[model samples]
Target: MSDTPSPLSRSFTEELWGGIASIFEAILAHPFIRGLTDGTLPEEAFRFYVIQDALYLRDYARALALAAAKAPQEQAIAMFCHHAAGAIEVERQLHESFFRDFGLTEQQVRATPVAPTNLAYTSYLLRVAYAEPFHELVGAVLPCYWIYQEVGTRLATRGSPNPLYRRWIETYGGEEFGRVVREVLQLTDRIAEALTPAQRAAAARHFVTTSRYEWMFWEMGWRMERWPV
Candidate 1:
């Protein structure tokens, strides 16, 4: 873990702006997401993915809520809880609309085994939330917020033909999500500034590992691969 700020964080806000810009560009350039935007994804498979996303969000909310109780500051924890509440709202809407459209039931989603990527991501988060310092946990969780906003914003720009895609994109790309990410990053930077060299290195390793697992989760979902140890 490097104690120094990431090249991207040396200028903090400017780096975040540039980072998000690059991220959105990359997402829009993704072939699968492009296919999704153009309504070329197989209907059944797309539906399956949507169902999975909704289920994942539910679990994500639970994980965040659990972390919130242990966050260092009352305001920070409260914000996390509020974010979880917002996620539940989106989950409900996705359930009522997209799930029904796809003929997916809550029971079916509940019965689905955690994909390897999903397990890796979730387990890492839970471990950070439970055992790491509050600042480190924030660093660990920031990727989730960043990734979704990145994907959602790019997907929105592509103007998906499916109403559901549009809804999902807008929900995440909107001002609310932006605000959350901004707040989290602000808190993370404050903590990062205070870390000892050894602690900073550890925190960076945790963040990078968590990010790699996030990518792994998507790969597993898309490839339908079994967990690979």
Candidate 2:
């Protein structure tokens, strides 16, 4: 047998990730993700996802800034602040490129109502950032960083014929983004070392909950989710 430990037998961060294996599998199986891999996704669905994502990033940046404020260490604070800036940069650059390609103007994207799942996901993160302990906030946000990296890395192997989708995969699958995710994972493990059993459980709960949201976000995009009256 290999020397590598199974996910369930691993330490904090790995254990947390392993516990949500089912959800991650579902996310990979999601139509939205599969379409990205095959480059068959409809333009309308992709447009809606990009718009919702741009809106989502603005609030996500805020939540990151809030996490920075709550961080106890200088390094942690700096990391969160940098991530916050990075999130905004992604919105401005990646999303903007997509917007232009889709013939969407900034005004139209801004005026577009936030999709229901998009709003709910961001609201959950912001609520955790404002109200939860720092460790829990980290748990809440980690899925976005970790899962995207996983998805990107996986899709990059298959590659899409569509240039735009290929660009999206490359962004997350690049070494720099992988390094960013690794840093956060390391930080999560370090934070876990100091947590009480109860605290660890709480953090795990948030991780699992946000993970479900991650899957839902894709499902929403697949459905081109809208707010119904």
Candidate 3:
């Protein structure tokens, strides 16, 4: 296989991305991401994020499995299934490494309560997975894939002084993750070609909403957000 990065589709999926240009810029400028670049973010905040992400990935994998089940084409089904398995693998390998570095056991991570934003984010995804059409589900999940790759690629340019943070950056910034995101983008374009105008609008709405949620997620980690109650 060629090692060159795949170009992202310039079709309807491109329009969806263009519509959110401002949101994407804001996400890149988010303090949590900036901190990742500078290595100034606190270990406590990182720990909270790691724990919450572990929680998020559990649901995210489920959502991907649902996507696989609902997929209209055999190729799409296989793709989603592969992604679902990849999600679980990331949780196991990446999080476990962080857990050891942070002196956290799996039991402690399990016992830790999911932060409010983390809960809200995953809940939205699961709701889409269970109830929404496949197109909308794909829209909802795209930001997590796309934004992380963008953030990681950008940060990997400067690189982090913190080894742990560098490792995190490498995961998303690597060519492997870029290839996966590009595949999803291509799938999104394929699905979009057949969408009704109304369906396109609804899918766009889901995409924007989840993109906003992606921003909130970083803030949640930065603040180490907790339940108000």
Index of the highest-TM-score prediction = 2
Q: State model 3's lDDT.
A: 0.90
Question: Of the candidates shown, which would achieve the greatest lDDT relative to the real structure?
Answer: 2
lDDT of each: 0.67, 0.91, 0.90
Quote the positional error of residue 9 for candidate 1 in Å: 7.8
The positional error of residue 135 in candidate 2, measured at the CA in angstroms, is 0.5
Clashing pairs in 3: none
TM-score of each: 0.79, 0.96, 0.94
Write down the worst ten-residue block by lDDT for model 3. Answer: 3-12
Q: In candidate 1, which residue ranges exceed 4 Å CA deviation?
A: 1-29, 226-229
lDDT of each residue in 198-221, candidate 2, tens digit only: 999999999999999999998888
lDDT of 3 by residue, 1-229 (tens): 9876455434778789887899989988888888887999898898889888888999999999999999999999999999999998965799999999999999999999998888899999999999999999999999889988988899889889999899999999999999999999999999999999899889889899999998998899999999999
Off by over 4 Å in 2: 1-9
Question: Which structure is stronger by lDDT: 1 or 2?
Answer: 2
